[model samples]
Target: MSQKLTLEQIQNFEGKYPKQLWHLFMVEMWERFCFYGMRGVLAIFMVDQLGLTDANSNLKYGAIQAFVYAFTFVGGIFADKILGFKQSLIFGGLFMIFGNLLIGINPKEFFYIGITLSIIGTGFFKPNISSMVGMLYKDNDARRDAGFSLFYSGINIGALLGGILCVHLGKTYGWSYAFLAAGVVMILGVAMFLKFKNELGPIGDSPLLNIAPKTRKLRELGVLIGSLLCIPFIYMMIQNTDYTDIFMYTIGPLAVVYFIYQLIKIPDSNAKSKFLAAFILIAFSILFFAIFEQAGGSLALFAKGNIHPSVFGISMDPNVVNNGANSLFVIIFAPILGLIWIWLSKKNKEPNTVIKFGLGFLFLAGGYYIFYTMRFFSDAQGLSSLEVFSLAYLVVTISELCLSPIGLSMVTKLSPKHLGGMMMGLWFLASAYGQYIGGKMGASMSVTKENATLIDKMLAYTGGYKELALYSLIAGLILILVSPLIRKLMREVK
Candidate 1:
């Protein structure tokens, strides 16, 4: 039976499929392409070109990612409670576009500005679009999960393409070209979104939509003028640096406090239970992401160090070989995973949200442990070839199936309807924490003659792997242990 579409509902219209959402997805794909693609080569760039040590590079990467998501807490609040979703996304995207463009130019003065704008932009963009997805569907619409699944597919499509293209281009042509390509694609994404504005309708709840445009314009001008006056003092405090931790230190805690206040403000018992679950979800997010995100750092390095290859009996370059695996995995597996969820749901065997999240962490822990154990083989067998690392990535990719796609879904699902973006913002906060911790872990892998030998380094990493396994095991156990309570909290939704 066809479900009745509500009258006030945003009509699917000629562009029934959420044109703004799709455009947003495409733009996000480009943005991620620039972001993660640069990430593919960034550590190497820092170490190889800028002559930074591995530890420094990893630390910088961690701090940057942490601040990027951390800011979303602030951005989401402004977007959800203040500016509403659409404006927040535009503000965020514009920042990201500007940042990517600036970084592509590779100027010292512009580099910081580019990253800063992008970071703040993502803070705004990341949470709001997701909340908009929530807005697209009404309460318990069967299509809600499907909408998120569609969104996840967009993410994978972008990430895979970004990694393959950026890594290959950076290695073969030039980093600048690779960066520029991502920026250009993102710009096109933005243009497409603007072109299709009529199709998007009024999906947003802009704070000032009721206010006159002139008043809003005046308010923005005031902010601009005030900011300009402070620039001289700001520049004195923050000297130009390509990689810095300013945002992590300053914006990070404030974001956390804001989230705390949000949790405290929940007026109803049911919403409070959901908020409680969201807090636990944050823990699981950290565990899942810290382990899964090794692709760009530890796993990336492992592939470089080991992994044997001769694709189709042709000697493929290692850089291409390394970059290509993730893209291939995402392309192949994402659709399959989506289908699996639908099938599971039809069979009435779909795992509850917490269980799914628990399994996600366990899967990542298992993948990393497999790779870490593979180290034993690499040393025993004399630096195992590309195939070894390839298998490892395959495992990580499967683990990603368990974690990455479902996180935001669970965020939207478990959160109260009114607080969609805030919950999504908190979701990224978990990722920000994971990014920070992952970077710290990666940085600790930096080897020195004084600290340990190659064997010692392997042993150290093994210890880290063991710790991750324990963390995941413990987190999974907690989820299962608390399953009854969380299920009760979920009430009739379960």
Candidate 2:
């Protein structure tokens, strides 16, 4: 028992961090390539290739994003209780690769099939990988936060590459090439993980102590079979908003109940305090994501329909500008912000977790308001300068720097060690709710062919932005007011 507990530490390199960090970093980079690559073009593909209405595209985007987040709960549970992190990662990556391949082969007929596969795959892959990262460090390890920051940068690097390359290929060549690129990169991610699993040691080992080998093998097989059986059901859910509505309504309460049960099971006050703080922060995160997620739904459509596709005399793809701008900014600013956080920590002047969340919401609101104000400058075609689009991403990226990485680190710090994977899933579930709402919000601004005058479309989108700005501002203020209390609930975590 003692040997198993100490395995990861024994393997740990004598450096600022563990050797496995780089391995996981590369794995995440390419996995994100698979994700954001497909994501960058999914909306436009639905609109252009399928001839779906604006409303339908936004709803489908929301539904797919919702499924992806919702499935993390399933993945996290299995990782914690059955397959362990390493197996789950491999399992998820394979599904994503196959799914992308299917989409590439015949998007029109197999679109839902491909999406269902990616949803299940991401569910298994995403949360467990983050849990594995958290497992690499002790609860009080100072390097954990910095490590996650670096990992977050890797995610953006992939996003930057995927956004630039995939969008250009999709637009210039066809959707098939873009999806094929996603599948190809996912294979690289899975290959990297397979080659580097040894560095991870027992960090993601199964939690059930001394379980029978035969029983464990059966459990793994059951999980695999069950996941496959879910595909048809997931495909049905993806095809319509009605099914997703039922899923969201059902899952939201179930998640709350699960968290409450976990909270009740905790035996220590310090752990309880940390869990409470995490719960409060997770609640506020929904608003942050609701606004921030517009980047993919409303903002993507806005760029495609309303912004010029050229900048500085260089022709640019709108999807590239839409997706790549944030990644470009993240790559530029993540290092600087990571250093800034470290510098502030040394001075004992770093902001608390709740304060960071508040700042995220404020920046998100401000970004939307910036776009809302630009409505006045729109031409008769309802088009705006590319600069406006770029600035929106800049402010939102700043907001993301404050919130996303901090939230990842915070979950690892505050969650009870045994429940790390489930906590990560809950964090993503917040994203699920926000994205579902974001889709509905975006869909509200839909412009059909009959009403599709540029000016009319611009007004609808700008109006939605104005509403989101107000909502984010209000949420930010509320979170800021309660920051001191939330910090106190974190006990000794910070």
Among these predictions, the greatest lDDT belongs to 2
Per-model C-alpha RMSD? 4.4, 2.2
Task: List the pairs of residues colliding in candidate 1.
Answer: 12-16, 307-385, 307-386, 308-385, 308-386
Candidate 2 deviant stretches above 4 angstroms: 1-16
Please identify model 1 stretches exceeding 4 Å from their true place.
1-21, 107-110, 218-253, 309-314, 317-324, 379-382, 450-463
Question: For model 1, what is the error of residue 358's alpha carbon versus the real structure, in angstroms, after optimal superposition?
Answer: 0.9
- The C-alpha local distance difference test score for the whole of candidate 2 amounts to 0.86
Report, for all candidates in order, the number of backbone clashes. Answer: 5, 0
**lDDT for every model?**
0.65, 0.86
For model 2 the local lDDT of residue 89 reads 92
Question: lDDT tens digits, residues 307-407, model 2?
Answer: 87787778887678898999889888887787787778879898877888889989988888888876886888888878877887799889898899889
Best by TM-score: 2
